[model samples]
Each structure stands twice: as C-alpha cells, then as structure tokens.
Target: MRAVSLVPSLSEAVARTAPGVLVGVTDWCTHPAALDAVRVGGTKNPRVELIASLAPDLVIANEEENRAPDLQALRAAGAEVLVTEVRDVPQAFRELARVLDACGVRARPRWLDEAEETWAALPVPDDRLRAVVPIWRRPWMVLGRDTFAGDVLARLGVTPVHADHPDRYPRVPLEELRECGAELVVLPDEPYRFTADDGPEAFPGLPCALVSGRHLTWYGPSLGEAPRVLGRALRAARR
Candidate 1:
C-alpha cells in the first residue's frame, strides 16, 4: 500500500519497517537519511494538490504535528487519513502497531521492540529533579501538562515544573520560568534550536541539560536510542 507521511517520525517508522510503502513524505521527514520519497511540503502547510496527485492509499499524521483543516481537506479529496494521538511511550507503541497493520505489515518492527526494552530496563532515578523544559524561545513556550515529552522526562526522574499548567504547551514569561524554583533547565534542540551556548545562559544558576529534541519529543525508531541518548545528556548537565 502506498502511503504519504505528514509526520517525520511516522515517515521514519514506515520507511524503516516497510521501505517501499512510502511514496511521499514532507520535506521535514529527514530520517532514513537517504529516503527517496517525493517531498510534498512542510507539516503544517503541505501541498494538498501534490499529495492528492500521488494517489496514495493512506496518509499518516499526528494530532499535534498536523493541522485539522489539512486532514479534513485530504478526507474531502477522498484520501484515507490515519490520525494518531501518541501522548506517551505505550501509546506510541500501540499507535505504531495500528499504523503498521494498516500498511499490511504483519511482523512487529525490531526498533519498536528495542525501544520498549530499552525504556523497560532503565532504572528510574530515586531522587527526582524538578526541571523546566523549554521547546521554543521567541515567546518562550514550554512542555506543560499531558505531553509526551513530559511523560518521557517523568519516567527519567525529571518532573516538569509546569506539568499542572492549563495548557499543554504554555507560553510562560522568561522571568516567570527563571523564578519557578526548578532545580534544572532542560532544553531540546528543535522547535527553537537551543544549544549549549544559546539556552544555558537563560537559566543562570540552574543546571542545564541540552537534549536532542528528536529523542525528547519524537516517537519512532529514535525511541530505541532515546533513553540512552537523553540519559547521558541529562547526567552531563552543568550549572
């Protein structure tokens, strides 16, 4: 079955598990580095005309990563859209299974098994650290309540300071975050491209952990390596 993936992680999942199934993907779907699919467009603003012209049997998207109107337009154009809502690791595994099933893949992908095993074998730190994880910087947005990143951090013994906030991705003031009493500052490298030189300066005295946004936020083959990759970064955090 030919498929078009709007989400990067989903693109990687399909490409890695069933190579020839994907006939189209967004320009942002950079995984499998040598992926040869047609680049439709960006996640938010995909070229619907180009996608419909591909005549794909299925299109995969995420509720958070894709816009509703785009999905509606695909449906309106008689395209079958499989929308996934993956809020945590378990949910990601389940959702991936569903997507693979739809793709006619009967065997479970090895990366999925490895990812689940990796997280399962990890020992949660006994001493939890309160951290403020910022995703974007212009207006200063952060990982708030019910997000997959928050759940990943919690399992690793780092609690999001704004986990109870009303919005999942809330835009809190810089000063408000600095004074939030968090023991550490977790910065991911996407959505805003935070670096050791760029993000750490914002939280003067707190230990700053510069993490890979893909591991911290994405759900796919990267999950297998996320625990180890993120753990090392978190452990090497400096004040």
Candidate 2:
C-alpha cells in the first residue's frame, strides 16, 4: 500500500489505519494532518492526474465526496479503490473495518464502543423527540428524510422533521414546520453558521441551539468520540 486519498469524513481513520503509507488528501482533509498535501484537490473535483501519478495501492472514496464521473475515471485508470458509505453508527463501524483492513492497520478506536453505550444510556427527553436542522438559511433548506443528518436524529431517539417540498435540498418554508411541533430546532455552524441573534425567534415557538454540523452528522473516525460529546448535549437539551 503506497498511498491513500480521502474526501469523506476525515483522514484520521485512514492515517491511523495505515500509519506508514503515504496519503494523498484534500486541502479540506483534516483528519490526517500529517498526510501529503501535494496531491491535494477539492472535495469533488480531485486532481486526477496527481492521483494517477501517485500510483497508490488503494484510493478510498465515498458517495458524499467524489462525483460519479471522478470515481469512474479512477476506476478506469486501473486504480484499486475502496468506497466507504457509513450513514449511521453501525454502518460507520463496518466502513472503518474495511478501511482498516485495506490500510493493514489494527487497534480499534476506544471511542467506537463508548459512543454507542453512552447513547443507549442517555435519558430520554420529555420534550418532543423532533428536530429541524437547517442546512441553509437564505433560501432556507433543511435535512430531509434518508440523509445522514436525519438518520443521526433517529439514532438519538429524535425525529427529523422536514417540510414536504420538491427539491432534495428544497427551499423549505417555515410555515410547513408549524405542525411538526418540534421542541428543539438545531442550526448547523457551517455553510451558513447561524446564531441565536440570527433569528431563533423566527421559530419562536421552539427551543433552538447552534450545533456543530460535523458531530451531529459527520460519521467517521471522529464519530468514535464525537457521539459521546453529542450525547451530553442531548442530555443537557433534555434537561
């Protein structure tokens, strides 16, 4: 295994799995800070030429990272590629296992099991187990069904409420949420980092908080410890 590349989650999983191999990662790839940045590329439009030149034994990609065309090109070039698509905890463990096996590394992360156990022991909130995660605000888009964000809430004993609209990333309407009766509305801190002053009153009927988008949604090596952090937050919110 000469090298690896990352686009989804963090390279920490890859680096920890393959400590000795050279890794080609994106400027956005923060998990493995020690990885070679020379072959760095964008999340979707990765430098194909740079990647091909690396002649890596394996290139790890995910549905969320590279586009179909980009992945097709790498495969067409005869590169050995492994795809990780972990939307929830169980899937996350399975993906980690594959990446670990490919990288020839061992030592399961302590956070993995801890996150699950902590989640199971969390006190169920008396508030409505429903939430609204606004991914964008100007046009007002929200996490819809079957998404990573939606699934995270489901695992946390919460329901993700999405307005029925056309686009997958639809410009959701506040009026639509009137019926959800979600006690808590979660606003992410990326792509549109919002604040209480930004307009929690817009949905004045609900209790809201600005949450880290990565922890609530991003499932990766970070998820190992990230879940515990989230568990505490959920408990606090419940209180």
Candidate 3:
C-alpha cells in the first residue's frame, strides 16, 4: 500500500522496514537519506491538497505532531489516516507494530527486536539524579508529565523536576528552571538545538548533559542505539 508519513520517526521506521511503499512524506521526514517521496510539507502545517493529490492508501500521523483539522480533512477526502499516540517506549513499539502491520510488512524488523533487547538489557540506575530537561529556549518549554523523553531518562535513572506538572510540555522561565534544585540539566540538540557551549551556562553550577534529541525523543531505528548513546552522554555530563 502507498503511505504518506507526517511523523519523522514513523517515516524512518516505515522506510527502514519496507522501502518504496511511501509515496509522500513531510519535509522533516529526513531518514534513510535517499528517500524518494513527494514532500508534503512540515509536520504541523502539512499541505493537505498536495497530499490528497498523491492518492496514498494510508496517511500516518501522530496526535502531537499533526493538527486535527488536517487529519479531518484527509479523512473527508476519502483517505485512510492512522493517528498514533505514543507517550512512552512500549506505546511506541505497539504503534510501530500497528503501522507496519497496516503497511503489509509480514515480519517484524530486526531493528525493532534489537531496540527492545537494548532497553531490556539496560540496568536501572541506582543513583538517580533530578534533572530539568528543556526542549525550547525562547519560551523555555520543558519536558513535563508523562513524556516519552522523560520516560527514557527515568529508565536511565534521571527524574524530571516537573514530572508532576499538569502540562506534558510546560513553559517555565530560565531562572525558575535553574532554581528548581535539579542536580543536572539535560539538554537536547533538537527543538532548541542546545549545545555544550550554549545550554550549560544557563544553569551556572549544575552539570549539563548534552544529548541527541533523536535518541531521547524519536521512537524508531534509533531506539536500538539510544540506550548506549544516551547513557554515555548522561555519564559524561559535567559542570
């Protein structure tokens, strides 16, 4: 079946598992490097008319990454849109299976198995550290309650300071984040593109773990290496 993927992680997952099935993808779906598909535009502001013109059998989207009006429009245009909501690792895996099954992939991909085994083999950290993870810097949005990134870090023994907050992604001032009493500040390279030179200084005395956002947030082939990659960054964090 011809599919159009709006989510970057899901796009990569499908491309890795079964190539040539994707007829369209969002501009941000930059995986497999040489993917041959029509650019449907950004995740949030996808080109509905262009996507509809492609005549895909399935359109893959995420509740967070896509807008409701767009999904509604696709369905109204007689397109089968599969909306996925993955709040954590298990949910990600389940959704991946569902999407792949919908795409007619008969067997589970090796990367999926390796990703599960990688996380399964990980030892839960005994020395847990309280961390404030900032995703963006302008409004200073941070990972709050029930986030996939927070879950990934929690597995590695890091607790988010605002994990109890009502908002999944909370807007907190930079000063308040510094004063939150977190032992370390975990900074990701995407959304805000925080670097060792840029993000660490905001916290003054606190240790800063500069991590790959793909490893922390994207739930796909990257999951196979995320544990090891994020583990090293978390361990190597320094003041």
Candidate 4:
C-alpha cells in the first residue's frame, strides 16, 4: 500500500507497517532508510498537491510534529489520516503499533522493546542525582518533569531542577538555574549543541556539562543503548 508520513518517528512506524509500500514522505521523515523511495514534500509544509497526486492509500501524521492545516488537507483530499502522539515510550509503542496496523506490518518494532527494558532497568545512584537538561539555549528551554527527557533522567535516579508540571520544555529565566536545586547542568547536543565553552558562563555558578542529546533524549530504538551511555556519564560526573 502506498503511504505518506509526516514525521521521522512515524516514518519509522510506517516503514514497519509496510516494508516497501511507503511511496511519499516528508523531507523530515527519515527512518527505515527505505523512505528514500518516497517523493519529497517539505517536512512541515509538505506540498499537498504533489502528495495528494500520488493517491496514497493512507497518510500518517504526528500531532506534535505535523502542522494542523496540512493534516486537515490530507483528510479533505480523501487520504485516511492517522495522527499519532508519542510523548513517552508507551505512547510511542502504541503509535508504532497503530502505524504498522495501518501498513499491515507485522510484529512489534525492536526499538520499542529495547527502550522499555532500558527505562525499566536503569539504576539509580544511592544518593540523589540532581541535574538540569537544557534542550535549547539563547531563549533557553529545559527538560522538565513528565517528558521523555525527564523519564530518561528518572531512570538514572536523577531529578531535574524543573518542577513536575505540565510544561516538559519550559523556557525558563537564566537566573532560575541557580535556584532550581540542581547540581549538574546537562547540555544536549542536537537542536543546539551546547559545548563546554558554552557552559556555566551563561549562569556563572552551576555544575554544567555537555551531554549526548540523542542518547538521553531521542526516544524510539535510539533509546536502546542510551541508558548504558548515561550510566557511564553519571558515574563520571560522580567522579
């Protein structure tokens, strides 16, 4: 069946759904690597006319990633639209399942299983591990409570300075870092690769360090080896 997907994560899901049937995908959708077969529409603002002309069986979209109008247009044009929301691992798994269901892909995806075990088995240090996860800087955003980033840190027994609230990535004031009750500042590499040089200089008095954003953050199969990597980092941070 021909399919078009909106985001990278769902693109992976769709590939798992129908191994070689994906015929159209957003520029941002890159997983299964086979999606190279699909014609390109911009990731966010895909050229609807081009995609609709393909006459795909269905289109997949992530609520978090796809712009509303594009999805609505796909639906209006007679494409069956499936919107997925994968904030945490479980949700991600379900979303993958749904996409595979749509694509007639068989069995669960490997990344989901590995990600679950990794989150469950990660060990916490005997003492409280305080940390700050900054996803972006210069109009800084942080990995706060109840997010994939927060879940990852929780696996390591670390607590983010941000409160456990509705906002997963709240743009906080620079001064708030000092008062957040955190000992370590984690700078994620992608989206904004924060380096040692870009360290505590922004907030003068924090124990800040650069971290692998993908390992500690990016959910899905990529999450498999992250715990081990993070464990070593936490231990080294302890040293």
Tell me how far the alpha carbon of residue 104 in candidate 2 is from the true structure, in angstroms, after superposition: 1.6
lDDT of 2 by residue, 1-239 (tens): 76556654646666655566755886666655556545558768888778888888888888776687888888888888787786656676677677766777666666556655665665665544777777877677887755666666666666776633344455667777555667777776754777768747678767776666667766665665555666566667656
Q: What lDDT score belongs to each candidate, Candidate 1 first? A: 0.92, 0.68, 0.92, 0.71
TM-score of every candidate relative to the true structure: 0.98, 0.81, 0.98, 0.82
Worst 10 residues of 4 by lDDT: 9-18
Please identify which of the two predictions, 1 or 2, would achieve the higher TM-score against the true structure.
Answer: 1
lDDT of 2: 0.68
Error of 4 at 38 (Å): 3.6
lDDT of 1: 0.92
Q: Which has the better lDDT: candidate 1, or candidate 2?
A: 1
Off by over 4 Å in 2: 8-10, 32-36, 106-128, 163-170, 178-180, 197-201, 235-239
Q: lDDT by residue for model 3 over 1-239, one digit each (tens)?
A: 89999999999999999999999998988887998999999998999999999999999999998999999999998899999998988888899999999999999998998898888888878889999999998889999998889999999999999999999999999889989999999999987899978888888888899999999999889999998899899999842
Tens-digit per-residue lDDT, 112-131, candidate 4 = 67667766665555776678
lDDT of 1 at 178: 97
* TM-score, structure 1 vs. true: 0.98
Per-residue lDDT, model 4, residue 167, is 86
